[model samples]
Target: MKLPSPVQWIEAQRKRGHELCLMLDTFDHKPVLQTLLKDRTHDRYSSLYSQTPIAELAGIGPFLIMLDSGDTQPLTELLNSPERHWGWLVSIAAQDFPALVQHWRERILVGQRPDQGIYRFHDNRVLGRALSSMPPEARPAYLGPAHSVCYAQGEHWLSADNRAPGQHPLPEQPHWLQVPVPPEQRARIRETNAHRFLLAHHQVAYLQLAEHRDPFDWLRLQRGRAEGWGWHAPRQLEFLLVSSLSTPEFEIPMQWHPRVYEEPSEHFERVCQEAKLLQGKGIA
Candidate 1:
């Protein structure tokens, strides 16, 4: 579905008495950090790592910046661009920025049992998947001070709201929260592995695949298909999946179909070459 323009969206939020803010991920790209610092103002903003043991890493960590009128245009451009993946735009019912910062700072470290680590919850993909996997009642733990959160998903913005009836903001600072790795995030790790592999070794195929479908869903489906075929090696499966992206049909050749354990690179190359020829003829 088409979303209202960012200007319209923000105007509507302001009319509803919500404070606008952005949770930016500098680790994704330096442009996000630069944008935040370039427009540095007296308006409330805090790095999620500030006042923490990793304070030195604040420059590259997640930052929560309350958006002001001057920030609309540049931020809107970034928010609307799908490839930027800067972070999420948030609307909060209250103007207590410190409380919102504290809410997220407490969740910086999360884990399952003895394996606590820096949670990349700031990444919209990770957050989106995590929210979808949780029961409605448990969503507020993540929603915290935000009235609603929106992030770029494919060609549109996806919003997740606190579903509980009353206000459910968490302002207290909790350290080293013991939260399990959401099943969706674990699956995303594998999916990203395949995507990174393609970007590194098969740029052409990566672009083609991205143009064809949502890369996340496509990679997940490819992983499932590979597993079902009993091709259990991670590297080999990645090769199979990425190689298929360059071809028109995106299927393994019949000759390779008989061999369950062998690498399918050779068969894939032949198919990819034929696909290129077809494209050259304007038939692909």
Candidate 2:
């Protein structure tokens, strides 16, 4: 089935009372987010904080947590430190933080590869297949191995450093002709493709506004775009404004045209301007 256009999706969401806005380089808005987290007057939503590792939280919920990995400090220290730059603004109904931790714990156990360490979901063989299946124009946008199936699987399979008692060496582990994509991963691949197309073609980004409680559902909706267009999310909206770092030359007037700005402030100003224009035109 053909999916709804990004604008159509945004309009459907707006009707439900959600406000969407786009900002460039979410890192620039760290102070604004910190303020939002401190003020709880907004009855519509509540902020959630967690000390858990982000990797474990991945695929757990619809919430996107942007961290400044540029800081070399430990994550725990970074989370509680007064200097903590970004804050998480989550919906009140979407407070599934504890459940997300539990889900990740379970997933860790299930994804363990006998002698190998944890299986990296992104490196799954199914993802490779999905990438290969995309049209040539869209395929190059996704970085990583897409040609050889074995290479992709090898990337995900983390061999144990030392074998446990009674366990065979990593090289001796049973080899399979094909590794089927888990049902959850399949759904992620599909949704990821949809989001990727939106970013690459429509030049829009989708952020997780509310908490998707189900791990499977949450995994499916993530933008999943690793590179290009400088993809990042602050909080509050599932899909944010579509903007690009480098403006593209387009023959037709795009509903949301990409433009380059000297600074993030300029980019954000342009985003707001464009949003207002679109609203005035009744586009969404």
Candidate 3:
């Protein structure tokens, strides 16, 4: 079959939110590339393991999300699985910790602040599991039962009462950037392992960044038209609640985990190579 031209392929992608993956020589293997064929397009959305990149899908179409860490498991299986309601959060086991610690370091030196903490053991039990999909060597040493600041974004240090947060930054951008969501946004993260328990009952929890001196004020200002509330999309706003100043103490804010997809370097290359091959076949 003749592969479509890159320009032609781009057009089709624009029409729908499907993803296009191209491989580069970054990995120690051959490259392959792939994407959606316009003719076969459908409205069905992707699941966690879908080949499509989540960042690409975010605002491009019509769909509801069940966010989960991208496990190699097939999308069909995830959607059909018995624990369908259970999605995934970030886990330390799946992260490159040495890289993460460095990032937090840079952030603090700049005085802008950054934190890197996500996953341990407590969060795993509370949130279902930890390091569900990370490479073994990269997994952090699970210190008994504990909470990761949050595997979301980047992790960070918390306040005395587990209220505020601070992060360290690496001198470099790190590898996760190659994934769907880039790490180290303006705000660093705290593993939300502690927050996972609340998720069973509340789909949207507005826990403070803890690092944010007054996360309360941040939420108020966030609720105002200033930054606007919601996940990914603007105005997809959500509701929030406050917890007491004691343990389990924090405010719930506007946030929900939506399934996201990213093309790992290996997969991206695989698809691109195929695209090129299809192109070759077409020419032959």
Candidate 4:
């Protein structure tokens, strides 16, 4: 069968209807998350989440935690400094993760306060919030959607603010991540972290001021040709394929096969032209 467009394939999946999300293991005790959050000192932090040995186990994928160390250092500085320009928020998708299957939720509800500033990634704003809200353990004090995923088994919430009312929620988890924090700063930390983490990991660099972290921002950006952004099709494809594969719609192939010959014959040349694409056609 001829393959449909990638977007079409995704749409088809959605149309196919319900997806199953079975609860895998809901650790009442979040050993991994706790370990990672430990000593979240700005000095030792790296923007790239993939670098962590355990990041992917929580469904964040390789680049999800990816942050520019230098850029991030500034954010650390922001947190450590007296007056910070940015504000912070953070969240995790593990709580909504489904082991088996479930219907994909398309709607996203982003909540923001009038005064909250949009701080992109590892910035002073977020660290300041973390510092203000999280307790000595560097964990969120109250049980949030983000924290809930770590605490229990069946579907529940780990992290998420009141803003995202019901835009097709990411299911639920069992337990909650309990942080020792004041009620006022909790929302700030969760919201700010969400923006920065998505900017670092997801394909798209420009955010829409929404609270949701879109994993496919890169693909949409490339297809839409976002301004002030230079991206080669190869790099764009790499990002999209990798991100999509993480929360895969289809199973991934086990092996890679390189072409035996360096150059492409007449057939290849014709195919390239017919496809109306030019960059990576050295084979032809």
Give lDDT tens digits, candidate 2, residues 1-284: 11222234334434654332211112234444443334333432222212333342222212222223232232233223312222221111123333322332332212132222222222325334544445433322222111111111221311111111111222222122134667675445445434433343443212221222332243243333211223232221122323321223211135433365434444435555776776689754
Question: Taking the tens digit of each residue's C-alpha lDDT, what string does model 3 give over 106-138?
Answer: 222111212222212211122222233233322
Each candidate structure's count of clashing pairs:
0, 3, 51, 54
Looking at model 4, report the run of 10 residues with the lowest lDDT sum: 99-108
On lDDT, the stronger of 2 and 4 is 2
Quantify all predictions' global Cα lDDT against the true fold: 0.66, 0.30, 0.26, 0.28
Residues 96-166, candidate 1, lDDT per residue (tens digit)?
67777877776775444333445666777767666666666676777776777777666766676765423
Model 4 alpha-carbon miss at residue 255, Å = 42
All predictions: root-mean-square deviation over Cα? 11.7, 21.8, 25.6, 21.3
| Model 2 lDDT-worst window of ten | 158-167
Judged by TM-score relative to the true structure, which candidate is superior, 1 or 3?
Answer: 1
Best by TM-score: 1
